[model samples]
Target: MTVKTFKQGVFLPHYKKYSEDQPITTIDLPNEVVIPLHQHIGAPCQALVRAGDRVKTGQKIGESAAFVSAAIHASVDGTVTAVEPRPYFTGTNVESVVIEVDPEQKEPVWPEQDLSSLDKDAIKAAIKEAGIVGMGGAAFPTHVKLSASKPIDAVIINACECEPFLTCDHRLLIEATAALVEGARLIRKVVDAPRVYFGVETNKADGIAALKQAIKDDETMEVVMLDVKYPQGSEKQLIKAVMDREVPPGKLPLDVGAIVQNVSTAIAIYEACRYKKPLYERVLTLSGDAAARPGNIRVRVGTPIGHIIEQCGGFKGASGEEARLNKLVGKIIMGGPMTGWAQSRLDIPIVKGTSGILIFSPAMVAKTEHRACVRCGRCVEHCPMFLYPSHIGMYAENGRYDSAVEWGAMDCFECGICVYVCPSNRPIVKFVRETKRHVAAARAAKAK
Candidate 1:
């Protein structure tokens, strides 16, 4: 009966009704896919297969020698058309492998592996080889995360899809409950943890119920209901809410005897360990007011956003006309509204970190130019990280990167809560990003 929660977060409209009841549907393989080599936080992968090479589904197409990088696999049986720079969801050009999907494609048959016999190292190796990353959008290589130096006491499964209009994780809980449970156990074993916790929000009653029923007989796992709050699914906040462990300002969950993985990430880990299947595809919610048909879809990682939009019934205007013709579609976001990137064009392809593709009509999109910080202090009161975003924004705006750093710019995860609550409509997340770039560049220069 005790619903656990973290401190300092904003309450917002769920906006999940559009796709929460919809079942997970698989989209047809896109004709061509642009698989970016740099989808994670670390070093980008080098193209393993050059143009004109034939690749099968689940084949490793890109890899890197860096310990922080995860491999990139071909999501479909296809012929590589090019290995060149392409537009990415981040509004930048990244080297990508473009593949033309073969028409006569068949389901990939992965050799079943004996999951019971795999040890901790074997499990970690399998995860890394499969190219599995944090499917909740952080895109941190999962294997690197499981390599905890500190002893871990528990593993928390983040089922709190707290971002507005995202129901893919909730659907995964209902449809892939068994896989999620198995994946949690695998993660716990890797960290040598004794227990697993599922941190879910109260809004997802069905998902919570399904998880509870699935873990009823398991003593090592339990479901922890979390309050429905924005940014509740963030790594540090989830750890705090579920395990009541505060990860230090510059530390990770493992530092506090816990490891947190998203719901979709857990499912990917299970598939990789049990079937030796690579993480080439994932489930994401396609929903917004402008989307003609909104639903949760299982899609390949490299599918183009344009192709996905057309296949998902295209865009619709307010009066039921084509949105493009009316210029009614204002924004296309690559992830959740809170932390997702605002896309300029639809030519970019979805990557491993993409959690959703949201299309919003002009009427639903707010058009406002960010003004100077009003010093109203709402951003400070509501920030889940409890940092002075106003000061950080002001410092970054004035090109004072060191001052921004002192104001905790590096510690910020850019959840956008500060911007959401800002009365002056100041773009705090943008300032934080700019500050981080400058600080990182300065550090590199100093090291040189």
Candidate 2:
């Protein structure tokens, strides 16, 4: 069978071998956790617990009245040590709730809700209370997705963990197949979608099989095999591949009467509605050449990257020994190499959207200086958004931020294909970032 796929996405090397087959292992609770209040895409949460307050596991510690935000919960029974600004993965300081875990832990109990009797409003309320967001890195509130304005007929469960070197979703599919399938059904019920499409890349044969077997004999859902391509798991591409629907530019999936969701988010929704569990922890990939031990890890929301590395046996060459993955280290990216942010340090805590951490040796880092863009159309040819990346990038680099937007810089999804194939090693994604920042700043100034 020919798998469906979106056009123009690059077929780069799939680097998921390190942890793709490794079963997930749980990390021990860290001594302290620094959970940010602004983990999602919308308004930041306000501190609900003050310093010196004792909190239980799954307790809400940060909350916002804003409809676009989700609550923050304590992952462990602990004492609030501080509610102060701390370093975040995106290179900004965010107000965070720092907790000191209690030496003795207790099994936590949550208020229960009957899933069969809950209405759509009640279900949405439960999702919001669970603090669930798009665990696939977008971090948008899940309840908002369920509250789509359009009447959706199809809901896509994006199991296409398309980013290179990230395989936590694959592990989830193999290990928790039933949970994921049931979760998809729960999601469909919430949105009243007629059918659910579980989209998986053809590369994940095991995941595809597991999902197929799990959804067998079920008429509400079907397993869709997608092509092997980078960014195929992206919401826009996933929708196109599974439903043959093109979301018009400047629109969303709801515009096409469809809603795309990360497989992890569905599982979280299931846990919340069934067991009344809050999303204080998540499963993420801890792979790459840099770590001494690379595997999938189930980590709490506020655990620091430094502790994660220590549990994984530290960086490739921590003991003054030259390990293969760490000869002249160049950059430590916090997510996948293609779209992840370069981390200045490892003190940042894991957030809901963190999918994987990557370490690149100097050999892998681009050493060539950013040069003038040649008229080559590689960026345009490879762009998934069909925008002139080079033109918008040049406009941004030249400080013509408005012109960059005029050239469709806003349309760029920062997939890094332009930067990947550029012969001159131009930082097209960086320009896109800058262009967006400037455009936002301009909007704010005008509003003020």
Candidate 1 lDDT for residue 24: 95
**Model 1 quality (TM-score):** 0.98
What TM-score against the true fold does each predicted structure earn?
0.98, 0.97
**What's the CA error at residue 124 for candidate 1, in Å?**
0.5
Q: Model 1 clash pairs?
A: none
Tell me the spans in candidate 2 whose CA falls farther than 4 Å from its real position.
110-113, 320-328
RMSD of 2: 1.9
Model 2: per-residue Cα lDDT over 1-448, one tens digit each: 8699999989978889989989989978899999999999898999999999999989999899999999999988999999999999988899999999999989777666677887777778889999999999889999888888779999899999998889999999999898888788778888889999999999899998888888789888898899989889998888888898999889999999898888889899888987889999999888776667889999999999878877888777763234433454567777788899988676889999999877666776778798898888998899999999989988888899889999888888899998998998889999999988888888999999
Whole-model alpha-carbon lDDT for candidate 2: 0.87
Q: Worst ten-residue run, lDDT, model 2?
A: 319-328
lDDT against the true structure, per candidate, is 0.91, 0.87
Q: Against the true structure, candidate 1 has what lDDT?
A: 0.91
Clashes of each: 0, 0
Clashing residue pairs in candidate 2 (N, C-alpha, C atoms within 3 angstroms): none
* Candidate 1 lDDT by residue in tens digits, 196-272: 99999999899989999999999989999999998999989898888888899998787789888999999999999
